[model samples]
Every structure is written in structure tokens, then in C-alpha cells.
Target: MLSGAALSRFRKNLMGWFAEYQRDLPWRRTRDPYRVWLSEIMLQQTRVAAAIPYYERFLERFPGVEALARAPQEEVLRLWAGLGYYSRARNLAEAAQEIVAKHNGVFPSEPADALALPGIGAYTAAAILSIVYQKKLAVLDGNVARVIARLYAVRGDLRANGTWQKLQATAGHLLAGRSPGDWNQAMMELGATLCTPRSPQCLLCPVSEFCEARKQGLTDLIPVKRSKRSTVELTLASLVLLDPRGQTLLLAPPAPARKSAAANDVHTLVSRMWHFPSVAVLQGQAAEALRKFAEESLFRGRGFRLEFFALKKVRHAVTFRAITIFPFRARVAKLPRVSASKAFPLADLSTVAVSNLTRKVARAALALN
Candidate 1:
């Protein structure tokens, strides 16, 4: 509830500090709405360091909204392969199509219009509008929320909608009219670098004088979150089918069991992309089941002399399961007709969206070939 000159002074001090010490990130170098939108989407559940390379690769492949809209869905998914949350990639493609059709291929300038785009919510819309367009809007992402909660010593479950609304209101009131972009960036920077979740460096904070948590010795406890749901485990068995010609096999994920009237559908992992034929295996049987399944499902039906090659393991965390993927490679006597696709080269391993585990197997198989 800062007001009058106090809010102005707070913003001035924060922005001044930001000018001196903001991190040099790739996204900060451009004001292009397309680039901002891409970075924001890629960073939804990913860290900055990981998102940077993906962002660069995506931009290089599809440089603009029109290019993204015209690109094949498979290509888009391939660019977004390792980055999980496949729905984000789908939404990104849909949004690009919308921008091209409805907005003449130009990104919407207003925050509300940006929010209307697929996969964009209030925080993303606000960020794009403020940072790219320099609009006088407050952006309250997780980082900003934590920073604001700690600064004002707001004590409640931040996950609660009421608590979030109150914090957003406070943030809106604090934004300086002249420098909304800098104010937003400063708040996010402070949260990310200084007001970290554990052992916050409050002593080095720019506006320590205005932080209630700093004054009251509650820097570590003000921004509280409810405990998350327990993670559920799942086991997957992935197959790498190789022919005598050294070509591998891939399958597209099946369509939804049912489609809504509006055509909105829920998609599974690796949806709309090229992936190795895989099955969910029972825990502890991943190794054996994969070998047997590959022999029966692939080789016996096609009459190929299958030789079990190397087995490579990959550990990745999905929403719940700490997935331990065991990739088993087998070389067959001949290539199956189902293994051919115009979109991907079964002979070339680099063109498909294989899981990280499968990628490891493919690389090993290539080296051995």
C-alpha cells in the first residue's frame, strides 16, 4: 500500500539499481514481441540457461510469425523436442496461426489481445506488453510475486487466489508511471538474484529499507507456498527398430480417444511428433520387457533376424514420474514399410523428435554402425 512520494522513491531506487546490475540475458537484447513471446513460452517451466539454446534454435528455424505458421507441425515439434510440456509447443503453433490469420501476421499490441492468444495468461500478457511495448502495466510472475510478498511481509499461502490478487493490486500501485518496464524487470531481477527462496541475500538488496521482511527478520518466511501434490511414478519402455540398411523406426502418437465439439483435445506426450514405438512397462521389468516386446512386436511379425544391440538408460522427470527410460536397440534383416516417412529420414537419425533416451540410443547405434 505504498503511496505518494514513497512509492516513487521506491521505484526510482529499484530501477536505478537494475540499471547498474541487470543480468545480460538473450531475451533482454530485443523488444520484438515475437521473440519475447517465444522466450516467455519456452521459459514456462524451464530455467534460463536451458531455454536460451532452445530459443536460439527456434528463432533460427522460424524467424517470424508467418514463418512459424507456415512451418510443418512436425518441424515445430522437432525444434521443441527435448523441452517437455509438448502442449506448449502446440499452443505456440496455434497462436502463430491465429496471429497470421486474424491479426495480419502481426502480434497483438494490447495486453488483452495478447492474453487472447493461445497459451498466454495474465502474467505472460503483462510481461510482453510492458517489456516489449513499454506499456504502463504491472507484470506479476512467480518471481515478482515472491519478491512482492517478501518485501511487504505479506503472510498467507501465495498459491491462494485471494493472496495473489492482493499482491497484484499492491504491485500495480507501486509501478512508476514513467518506467513500467524497468520497474517490472527490477522486481523480477531482485527476486531471482537476491530474494531467492533459500538464504536470500537481503543485505545486498537495493530497496532493503522498503522491505518489511528485511526490517522484521522474516526474509525467508514471508512468501509462503502450500505443499505440492506427491509425484506419481510411471515406467516406459522405448524401442529402437533398425533395419539391415541401418534405418530406424518411429511412430506418431495416437489421436485423442474423443474430441470435444470445439475440437479442443488433450494430447499425450510426444503427440504429433516422430517417436520410437514404445509401451509403458511395469516397474523393474523395463529392461526385460523392452527386449521381449521388441522381438515379438517388431521382429517376429516382420521376419527379421533381430540382434539385440546396446541398452542405454536415461532419467527424466515428467509431471509426476521420475521416468527411468531404458532404450534397447535391435538390428533387423530388412526394413519394414511402416518405418518409412517423407517427413523424417529413417536412415538419418537427426531428423526425428525421439525422446532423450532414444536420442542416446540413436547416437550409440550410429557410432556402432
Candidate 2:
């Protein structure tokens, strides 16, 4: 609980240091709520370096809220294909439409109003409103949380809700009222560059004199790490059926079956996107499992002999699920007309909205040829 002269000195040191050393991010160049909101959303689980290109390209394609709202969902997903966490792109467009319809294209200034948007949460609402509208709010993201924990020598599970709330209070208390935007950015910059999680450069920190963890020689020990969820390993088998005209077959995930279907029937990796016909398979039986799946579902009524070649295996992950994909390709005179399946030009797959896992599958199958 820093206060009085000590708090004033801490604020001065942090702001002065920030003025001399903050990174020149493109988002910092403007106070536009839309751009700031977009950057905040994109930065949510992505690294800064990986997010910059996507941010620039997304802004170029849909320059403003109205443009994003007007664009088709598929097109937005296509442009955001490689960036992953596709729900963010979807919600961004939905929230834009919401702004246009409800607020007449102006970003909501009120904290509650901002939080009412599709993907905006407490931290997001606070960050966007503070940085763009100069609202007196503090951001307590992972980096900022780490800095706060180390500053006060906070110990225990920092991920715990009670611990987190205390850190948020500390952050709000330390916020520089007059320069809320710069103050928030300065705090984030300090955590990201100097107060890093591992091997923090305490000696170079602008506020080292005020850090309680440094004073107690606990800089490296404070801020206990959060436990990770256990990974679930899975095996997936996919079929890439291509016709002589260079079109590849894709299928919508099958509807959940009742208990009547074979016990071996597999589940699709992703839903709501077109993907190669695939199924989860038992270890060491990928080929046999896919053959059975294709014969029963893909060629049930149609009379076509199945001849397939195995392609390279692809490894992918979604959240805690670690997957190893066994891809098989078959050349046919023409693709079968299966229900819930469609054919797209293989060369133009980029135009379609598909998961990164699907993209990896396509790349693996293509690379071998």
C-alpha cells in the first residue's frame, strides 16, 4: 500500500522512465477506440510480435467498425485464418454490428456499456476505455499482475480470485490519474520488458527502489506460477479425396449419433467449418479405422472402389488436446456426392474458412506430393 511521498516518487520514476523508453507500437499512435479495442482483443492470448501483422492486415481489410460489420463472416474468418482463436474475429464483427445498430458507430465510453459487447470483458473494458477515452481505470493483465505481485512480495497462487482482486486494487491505487492512458501503458511496458516472468532484470528496473520483492531478495521467488491443465493425447485419421479436375472434398462435421452407431465411430476435431472427412482413431490402427469410416459413411450407397495412399502425418494442438493426424489421399475420377459435403478448388483453399488444424492437414497432404 504505497502512499504519500513514496507513491508520488514511484509514479514520477515510472512515468519518466516510460516517456524515455516505451516501444513505438502502431496502436499507440492513435486514440481511436476501434483500433485500440481491436489490438486489445488480438493481444488476448497471442504474443505481441505475432499479433502486429494480423492487426495491420485486419485494419487494412476492414478499415473501421462499419466496414467490419458490413463484411461477411466467412471473409473475416478467412483473413484471420492463421491467427487462430477464430471466435475473436467472429465476435469482433458481431460487436461492430452491435455498435453500429445500438450506439450509432461510436464506441461506448461507459465501462458497463463496453463490457456488454460480444468479446469484451472486465480487463478489456477497462483497458480500452482508459487508453482511448482517458477513463481512470487500471489494466491487470498477466504481465501487470506479475509486476504487482513482485512489487508487493505477494505470495500464494496469484491465479486465485482473492489474490487477483487484491493485485487489481493495488494496480488501481498506483495508477497515475492525470495520465491514465500513458500510466497504464507504462505499467504494462515495465512488466513486459523489465519485470519479465523469468530472470527479471531487477537492476535495470526504473522502480527497483520501490519493489518490495527486490528489497526482500524475493524477486525470483514471488508470483507463483499457475498450474497447467493436463494434456489429452488423441489420434485422428483424415481422407483427402481429390477428383481429376483438381477439386478436393470437404465435409461438415457429422451430427452426433445415438448409441446405435458403431462404438468405433469417431468425432470431428472442429465444428461449424468445412474440413476434410476425418475421425478419431485408435492408436496403431489409423489406416484401418479410416478405411472402415470411408466405406460405411462416404461410399455407403455409391459404387466406387476405394484405393488410397498414405501421406505424411501432421501434429496439431487445440487447447489441452494434443493430436497426431494420419492423413490418407485417394485419387478418383469424380468425388462422391455425400450429404453435408462440398468440393472446393484445391488451389484456392485459402479462400475458405477452415481451422488451423485443417490447414495443417492440407499442407501435410500437399507437401508429400
| Tens-digit lDDT track of model 1 for 1-369 | 777788778878898889999999999998888998898899889888889999999999999999999987668877888887777887899999999998998889887778889899988887788887788889888888888888889898886878889889888988877767777888888888988888988778878888898899888787875687686555667767666555667765545343432211112433445667666677778767776766675555555445556465656565654655566676555555553332344456567665554565456555555
Model 1 residue-pair collision total:
0
- For all candidates in order, the CA lDDT equals 0.74, 0.85
lDDT string for model 2 (1-369, tens) is 899999999999999999999998989999999999999999988888999999999899989999999998778877777777777887998999999999989899999889999999989998999998999999999999999999999998887979889989999999999989899999999999999999999988999998999999988888877788898788889999888888899885444242323323343355345688888888899889898888888887476577878988888876777888899988888888889888987666886878877888788777766
TM-score of each: 0.87, 0.93
Clashes of each: 0, 0
Question: In candidate 2, how many Å is residue 346 off?
Answer: 2.9
The C-alpha local distance difference test score for the whole of candidate 2 amounts to 0.85
Stretches of candidate 2 exceeding 4 Å from the true structure: 252-268
Measured with C-alpha atoms, the lDDT of residue 4 in candidate 1 is 76
Which residue pairs clash within candidate 2? none
